[model samples]
Target: MKSGGNLEAVLNAGEFAITGELGPPRGTSIEAVREKAAHLKGMVDAVNITDNQTAVVRMASWATSLIVIEEGLEPNYQMVCRDRNRLAMQADILGASALGIRNILCLSGDHQQFGDHPRSKGVFDIDSIQLVNMVKNMRDEGKFLGGDDIDGPPKLFIGAAANPFGEPFEWRVHRLAKKLAAGADFVQTQCIYNMKKFRQWIDEANDMGLTEKIHILAGVTPFKSIGMARYMKNNVPGMDVPEDMIKRLKGAGKGKVATEGIKIACEQIEEFKEMKGVAGVHLMAIEWEHRVPQIVEQAKMLPRPVITPGSGEA
Candidate 1:
């Protein structure tokens, strides 16, 4: 019942929640946000609004979240530590809550070197785990990081990211445990291409009893082309796109690669539904928001569950 957000309600009700991602436009265009939100409305339990994802500047996540709310959809507001110190971070947290934002995703954003402003200095005042703990304290303890009491605390469903494909595989589950201990209410993993490795990671998480403590939403992203597949495999850190998958995209021939990618994503989502410790799926359609309804329909996850007010708590 924490936050009473749609995402929290769905998970608390034992429904297989489906969340989508919406990257804000590079400029201030309310129509752009609305258009993307239109594609996601009702197709997902919530939509994640990214915060200058991949180090590229864009419309602020909180502002985009409010636009999404106006479009009749819930937003999972994202905050990255790469650009803000504790002062700005806490200020935004309070503002986001006052704006009715219910879910917040804490992240250590991609390094500035990867973005348009390569020379920008990062303000990594605190890491993602610490961000999670700070948010939790603000919500539950009604106090700031420096121990000052807040008149009104943010009521948010806290979330953190995980990469099952991250190297030194043995350490993945432990990292998740750290976030859980930091009071993360839910987790969304990196896009899963290697099912075997992902299953192993989740199995270890289950073994440690972490699943009982937090909700894990398996991440899924559809490849638009073989080039995209290869880029993710060869370039994106912590992204494990197996060669066979790239081959599958290539096998789709010239005009059909996107279709095949959606098929692959749908298949992976089906498997996640059956996997233990997976509470739901986080569909990162990545500018392909128009295809989300089709993917949900094809995966038979349509007609997302309706959670009544006050039904989230027992």
Candidate 2:
């Protein structure tokens, strides 16, 4: 369910939500960024601009979020603490809200050393949980990090990340609980490839009485190639793919693997849509944005209502 104030309107109306990820350009030109935003404008509820995803250098998330707003698409802007201190982090949060971007996803970004930029220094001034608490304090208390009151406080829907398949599976539930305690309104999990693991994670969350506090969106990404799968497994922290899925993809012929990936993503989403704690599916189609609508439709998750003035409140 879209639990963010503005996003909730969409969920309350029975909208099967859609969100896209944009790796903002490292260079100045936003032509490519705008083009991607334009392509998903009416098709998605919002576009998430990843902040230095994979620890790779790229355009700043705040600027790209503003660009997405300018392109007429809502932005679920990503804020990672690996690159900024609490001071910068707080400023960006206020800045984004002032720019009219309502959704903020708190993340402890991947280390720069893990990404292509090994030479870049890593900054973990505050982990994702602290960032969540910071934003909540800012919005709820009407004060900045320094305890100074503002004329107009920022408003936003706070989100945090969860990885069920990460090492020590039980930690996922624990971390999620911590995030909720820190005032996370919603959670977008790491890309899920194994359903059993996801269910186990959800059950643990439910047992802790967390299922009701925050909206959980199952994250799914369609693999474009076997090589990419390997990259994800080897490089991405808090991500683990099963042997069976890799075997299946490996056995599939080159031309057929991507189709299998899409099919698997669709199946996973279909199942995730039915789970008890799940709010909805956040399809990270990545470069395959064009396939999202079809994937949702083929999975029988379409026919969403309009999220507008007349929709009743949840």
Candidate 3:
């Protein structure tokens, strides 16, 4: 049952697990994959390999995940409904398992309008929630989507995305519950820039006892520059960036802005450590992977835990 790599190992051991994101290279060369994964090797419990993120074409998450494993890193393979139907999705579960992939993150994906291939046809054959349920069924019931028996089902740790800052805020927690109900083992929330709103959302989850049933890692990303902050605030849908945060980043000296960003990220990680219902922090530095070691070390999240067989088993 531990096929999802150390992600399940770390989570089951009840440690504050750290997860990172790695977008696959646009080309086929595996060297690009190794270079990006090198930054996160020991710093994170797992690395989420995005599936054609932002609708832009990239190396397949499944392929990249195998590369991560080759580099001795755990991959949380992301799957989007944009390109695959339920049939393809189910096939991937088996294929990925054969390739030694374990953890999987289900996503509805960014609309095609946002990617380079705007004219690409969208495949809404099944939404993310349904995908979660399907994968759960495959794992638990050992059956294919059409009820055919599987030879050997994939043993995966399921994950879903949540956005605390999205509008109709109070209901966001309920949405998270829906993912859990659909059989999500864990959840990684969207980047949380609005701490106040995230606290509110978390309070709702805690009140409902959802956090106790499933692991929830709050997403944290640092703003590298004034322009980045502005883009997230003004352009990113479902993101809420406060004026104070923008001001702090803008106030920093030109040469020190990146350091300031790291400082801010560390502060959020520190707060996440003490927050109720938060299992850990999901660090998404974007292309800023090099800063991950510094941020986690400064946040005192280094010296990652080691899980033995008896320690992490269900």
Candidate 4:
């Protein structure tokens, strides 16, 4: 019953969990956040509030997470190591817990150079794996990183990011194992466009028995247009968009690419449902929140299952 959150309960109950992402607005637009969350309210088990994603500044993740909760959705609060020291990290964890944020995704955020602020100094005091261990200790030991006692430790279901498409392919599984050892209860991988490679990676995890130790939620994103597909294929690091997929998008003809993209995403979700090591799908409909329900329904993941607390059954 880790964290007693819907995500953990769904995974524990052996349901194919669905999670969505919500990027905070660049300014103080609470309405904007709520509007985006409204699109995903009942379509996903939990929503991940990205923390200064791509190193661009925005509303703080913890605050946005609270807003999502106010909208009647559980938040998977994301924390990146690029902007905060350990002290700030632990403080934010405590604050998020106090605010009822039960799920968190730990990450080594995109480097600052890639963002609007190229000159900003990064404070990568600790890597993502270390951050995972820190959170686990706080939850299980009720102690701070400095070994100090806490009046109340955060009971969070910790998560970390995985890049199964990263090069030196053999090391990907080992990296996941390291995160599991560091106490990541679950992981959401980089966007998976290369299903062949993803299947191989999951098979490796299954062979190592890593799947049983950690919940691996395969990441999926629909290509909104041909430009998006080409950009991800050539520009995005660790993204593997097969050429045939791009051709397929082109084959869809003008004015219909977006629809084709959604169809492809639905097909991917169907495949994920049958994948052995996959516990769920993390639908990262970047800025396309309004389309989430359509995709989920088309994938036949509609009417999400309900898991009663402490029962571990959907």
Give the clash total for candidate 4: 0
lDDT (10s digit) by residue, model 3, range 228-294 = 9899999999999999998898789788788898899899999998988999889999998888888
Clashing pairs in 3: none
Error of 2 at 257 (Å): 1.1
What is candidate 1's lDDT per residue for 12-89, written digit by digit as tens?
Answer: 999999999999999999999999999999899999999999899999999999999999999999999999999999
- Candidate 2 regions with alpha-carbon error over 4 angstroms: 1-5, 12-16, 310-312
Report how far off residue 226 is in candidate 3 (Å).
0.9
Please, what are the lDDT tens digits per residue for candidate 4 over residues 1-314? 76989999999999999999999999999999999999998999999999999888999999999999999999999999999999999999999999899999999999999998999999999999999999999999999999999899899999999999899999999999999999999999999999999999999999999999899999999999999999999999888999999999999998999999999999999999999999999999999999999999999998998887788943
What TM-score, computed on C-alpha atoms, does each candidate reach?
0.99, 0.92, 0.98, 0.99
Tell me model 2's lDDT, rounded to 2 decimals: 0.80
Error of 2 at 272 (Å): 0.9
**lDDT, residue 57, model 3:** 96
